[model samples]
Target: MKRGIFIVLEGPDRSGKSTQAALLKTWFEALGREVIVTREPGGTYLSEKIRKILLDPKSRIEPMTELFLYETSRIKHTLEKILPALKAGKVIISDRFTLSTTAYQGYGRGLPIKTVETLNRIATLGLKPHLTLVMDIPDKVFARRERAGEKLQGADRIEREPDSFRRRVNRAYKTLARRPGITRVNAGRPVAEIQREIRARVAKILKRQAWKRGNKKQ
Candidate 1:
């Protein structure tokens, strides 16, 4: 059987990654495809445990330490969950993946890009998303969202970073968006508008994948 499609939604905190992941899951379900929706750094049991430490505001995790924690979580999440689902031919809609590390650690934390990329490769075992949707939002919007009440109760360690850190992460995202296999979606617009755009782009990729599979079946 053909492996499943992997779609990763990436963005900084409060950037609508969760909302989009949900919408994408719904869209894939409506199409009658088997789908497994998961999130990075917390997909598996051990990964969730790692996530707690990584996100706890009181935790004083060094940048390198944070990087290793993320990698370990990815290794577990990918091996136990993501890989098996793909092997079963189930579509995977993930909230974040290795790209997150690249943007957050490499760019946001100012770690060496080469080192970050190397670690990501090790964690993922060279697996990559077929398509990545980057939700791009401005700092002004982020500031407003951060100020809004009720987002903090569940806020984690990463969200507690300063505005300067957020800007750096956003910059990393912008740079990565220009690379291959990545699409940038303006998230400052209406949520519906953003979802519509995402659906349209994803549709194209699905169609292309379908064509490839059809050829293989011939």
Candidate 2:
């Protein structure tokens, strides 16, 4: 059987990664594909438990400790959920993934980029996403959203971080967007417009995958 595509929606907080992920899943299903919508740091049972600790506002976790916890959650999520889904030819639309770690911990927290990359490779066993949609929003738009109280309800530890940290993370995402296999989407636009751009990109990926499979059989 042909291996399935892995698409990740990665961005800073409240950038509509979750919303786009859901829309992507629906679009894939409409194409008669098996779609699995999941999130990082909380895919499997144990991972979900770890997620609570990682996101709890009261948890005072050191930078290295936080990094390890995320990687731990990722390894479990990969082995128990992601790999199997892909093996079964199911498209996996994840809310966040390794790029998130690189952005948040490496850039946002001022951790060593090389160290973060090493841990990421170890955790995911070098598994890479076929497509990563990096949702990009301007600082002014982010501020507007905050003022509108969009994600203020029971904010997580990361969400509640100070302005400086958020600025670092926002910049981190823009930097990461330069990497190959990642598409940066202007998330400040209307939701439908953003989804249309995402769908166009996803269609190209799916088409390419189908072409490759056909070539392999010939």
Candidate 3:
């Protein structure tokens, strides 16, 4: 069977990655594709446990400690959930992936980018997403959304971080956008507009993959 498409939607908190993931899943299902929507650090039972520790505001985790936790969760998520889904030919729409770790732990926490990349390779076993949509939003928009109480009540540890940290993360995402297999989406528009743009890009990728497969069969 053909390996499934792996798409990751990554961005800062409240950037609508989850919303886009859901929309993408629905769109894929409508096309009669088997779709699985999962998130990093919480895809499997062990990963979910690690997610709680990583996201608890009361917990005090050192930078390197936090990094290892994320990678540990990732390996489990990759081995238990992602690889199997791909082998079975099911589309996977993940809310966040390795990019998040690079942005959050590497840039936001002031870790070495090269070290983070190496760890990411080890954790994911060198599996890369087919497409990664970096949902880009301006700092002002992000602050406004936070001030507007978008998710103030249930803010995760990362969300409760200082503005400086969030700014670093935002910049990291912008820098990461230049990498291969990444498409930066301007997420400051209306929800429907953003989804439309996402769908268009995804359609192109699907078409390209289909062409490649047809040629291989020929």
Off by over 4 Å in 3: 1-3, 146-154
- Tell me the tens digit of each residue's lDDT in model 1 across 1-218: 64588889998777888887788888888988888889888899999999999988899999999999999999999999988898898999898999999999999998999999999999889999888888898877876765223445866788778878888999889899888878988999987899999889888878898899899889
- Candidate maximizing TM-score: 2
Worst 10 residues of 3 by lDDT: 143-152
**Cα lDDT for residue 137, model 3?**
89
RMSD of each predicted structure? 2.1, 2.1, 2.1
Give per-residue CA lDDT, model 2, range 10-40, as digits (tens). 9987788888888888998888899999999
- How badly does each model clash, as a count of residue pairs? 1, 0, 0
Candidate 3 local lDDT, 52-158, one digit each (tens)? 99999999999999999999999999999999999999999888999999999999999998999999999999999988999998888876664232445677888
Per-model TM-score, in order, reads: 0.93, 0.94, 0.94
The global C-alpha lDDT for each of the candidates, from Candidate 1 onward, is: 0.87, 0.90, 0.90
What residue runs in model 1 are displaced by over 4 Å at the alpha carbon?
A: 1-3, 146-151
